[model samples]
Target: MLDWVASLPLWQATIFLFVVVFFRAQLTFWLGKFMRKGLIKSKFGKSGQNAEEKRAGIAALEKYGWPVIPLSFLTVGFQSVVQLGAGFLDWNWLKYTLAALPGYLAWGFIYAFGGLALFRSITNGSIGLLIIALIVAFLVWAVGAVIVKKLRTNG
Candidate 1:
């Protein structure tokens, strides 16, 4: 399914992944912004403990978010939180964009180059461990899915 990405030249692949990361981050940020705006428009965010918590959360995020944004890219789930939280906190555009750009570019280069290298190594000489790891991963996912499905049905 993802073979075409490997076929692309390094520069093209880098650009492609860069755009992918850019759009994904933008979308995640906007989604949070939209939710925040909707909450503001409605009565839900007007006055409450939730509102106070939200305010405090926003303050803390603003104070620390710039530093965390770059580190977020190295993670999986935490990346989304940092990106979305930036928007939820109504972070300034320049600050957030500047903070996030390095991570985005780093991801682009790492994935574009590291992924190609992995595919090459797997195809060329190091298939044994890679295949075993992939098989184990698939088995784990399949087993976990079946268990979850059964639990859902029983519950």
Candidate 2:
């Protein structure tokens, strides 16, 4: 089933990307809002000046918004957070969309084209490259998860 889907034409892919990006942006926006709420309720944040702190968070989010899109591609939960943060902080949605779209395309091309290139190179050789790829992806996810968990727990 997925193989059939994978063989989709360029138009399908484009539409798919659009839909995915739209929903993802919405999700990110809400995630930021909820995270703000959670932070407010948390012990560390509760004792502080809530309005000032919220404004600071919003400011920090706007300042560092675009980079988060690409960084999220590598990290555990960055994608959603970036979306949410930008949304809650009222960053220009158009700019966020533009920045995130190219980053997403670059990421897809890197992984997809890289995989195909690797396969072509390794066609008559060993499976070491494939194995290494799997291992690296796993390690990336694991490390990202740990970092995200730690940040959430401590922040």
Candidate 3:
């Protein structure tokens, strides 16, 4: 799969990345619809609840929705999970798409170059450098994930 992705031309790669992100966003929306209701029931449905509890759920969902689309590239299962969470919270599809575009672009570029860089480094016997680059990429992804978490929490 990595070889196949690597073989794609730059334009094709960009288009593929965009399509993946867009479809993933839509998937999140659909998944959220069912899960949010279940979550609401689990949180406040079983017992007599005030309006405040419902409000809290909505508020949490709104705050977190933006980051889900952007950080979808970092965490293994997290990208899809966040998208679903946003959808369940009833976030606007447009808002999610906007937040996701730049981040996905960044991720796609990094992945494309990173793949080539790693292969070159290893082929040239710069194994140590290759390892370092991989670590750096991981760190960058980690930082991106943190930003996403913060945005989701504070927004």
Candidate 4:
């Protein structure tokens, strides 16, 4: 399957990546919905203590969630959370799909081409370079994270 994808043109690769991400995101959304339904059926949801608060929270999420989908796509480690949050909120399928389109395309193009090159690089005996690059990237990320934390704490 991956070999077939690798042989395709760039545009086709992008489409394939888009489909993959779309499927994954949709599946995540569905899982969120499933969990949400379970929660509603659970004892906590049955309790009326926080009914007003729950309603308000859902209202806020639905109202302010439009930007989150696209922004999450541009970040690391936050995409699944936002996608699941949408599903848990029972976001309209159409709305979620539309909001997520840009993210889909961005992720698609990035991974489609980058993944191919990355695979090729590894297969062509660039393992040493790949390892070095990975270490450097990790260091940069770690240093940047520390700097940001210190700035936040000291600012």
Candidate 5:
């Protein structure tokens, strides 16, 4: 898959990425919608601490609105959660789609360029560089997670 994508023109690869990410996000949103009822009844539903967490999630979404759609892309696992919350909350479809455009574009750029670069580096026998890059990526992710956690706690 990486080879196939890497062979494409940058513009084509970016477009392909945008389409895939956008559709995947939309699919996740619909899945959230479909599971809304079950989610309400399940463990993370309206019972105990889960209820408070749910309320917090809803409040965050409400506080941020459509901007959250795009910002969600920056976080690894949280994007789908936000999309699900958007669907479960019944946010306007047109607004969600429109707001998602820039997010998807950013994702496309990152994946297309970054993936290609990583693929090339690996194929060229640059394992040491790849290891360093992975470590740096992990550190960045860890820092971002900590910052997000602090924000969530303080907000």
Candidate 6:
């Protein structure tokens, strides 16, 4: 998949990626909207009703506002949550799209260039480099996980 995308013309690939990201955020937003009512009626809904959760979410919104949309793109698994949260909170469409456009472009560029670079490194038999990259990635993940854990616990 990376190879196929990397082989496309730069502009074409970027457009394709931007569309994909846009649709993904839209889909997630709608999903959240659809699920919010149902989830709130469920047994697990108490968590969302908690004062702490509400306060934390509000604090985050006050601190980050729409910027979280773009920042979320840098994380691997949290973008969906951010998009869904926007919908659940009833964020304005124009604001969400405006924030997400740059994020999608950044995501496109990163995937296009980084994917191609990784592909080249693999094809060139740079096993040691790949291993080192994997190790570094693992360490980063570990540190991020710890930080998130601490923040959650502290908050």
The best candidate in terms of lDDT? 4
Model 2 clash tally?
3
Estimate the lDDT of model 2. Answer: 0.58
TM-scores of the candidates are 0.66, 0.48, 0.57, 0.68, 0.61, 0.61
Task: List per-prediction Cα lDDT, in the order shown.
Answer: 0.72, 0.58, 0.65, 0.76, 0.74, 0.72
**52-146 per-residue lDDT for model 5 (tens digits):** 65567556555556776897776555788778877887667787888888999988877777754664566576776677677657855874576
Query: What is the lDDT, from 0 to 100, of the residue 47 in candidate 1?
Result: 55
Best by TM-score: 4
Comparing 2 and 6 on TM-score, the stronger one: 6
What does candidate 3's lDDT look like per residue over 1-155, in tens digits?
55776678876776676676667667766788777667668846556345665666567656644665676665444566666766776677678668877767766675665644564556576776667667757865885687566555654
Q: Model 4 — TM-score against the truth?
A: 0.68
Stretches of candidate 2 off by over 4 Å are 41-46, 50-61, 74-78, 84-95, 104-155
Ranking of all predicted structures according to TM-score, beginning with the best and ending with the worst? 4, 1, 6, 5, 3, 2
Residue-pair clashes per prediction, in order, are 0, 3, 1, 0, 0, 0
Deviating ranges (above 4 Å) for candidate 4: 1-7, 48-50, 115-155
Residue 147 of model 2, lDDT score = 46
Better of 3 and 5 by lDDT: 5
In model 3, how large is the Cα lDDT of residue 17?
Answer: 66
Could you tell me the TM-score of candidate 1? Answer: 0.66
Badly placed stretches (over 4 Å) of model 3 are 37-50, 60-65, 115-155
lDDT-best of 4 and 5? 4
For model 5, state the Cα shift of residue 151 in Å: 13
User: Which of candidates 2 and 3 reaches a greater TM-score?
Assistant: 3
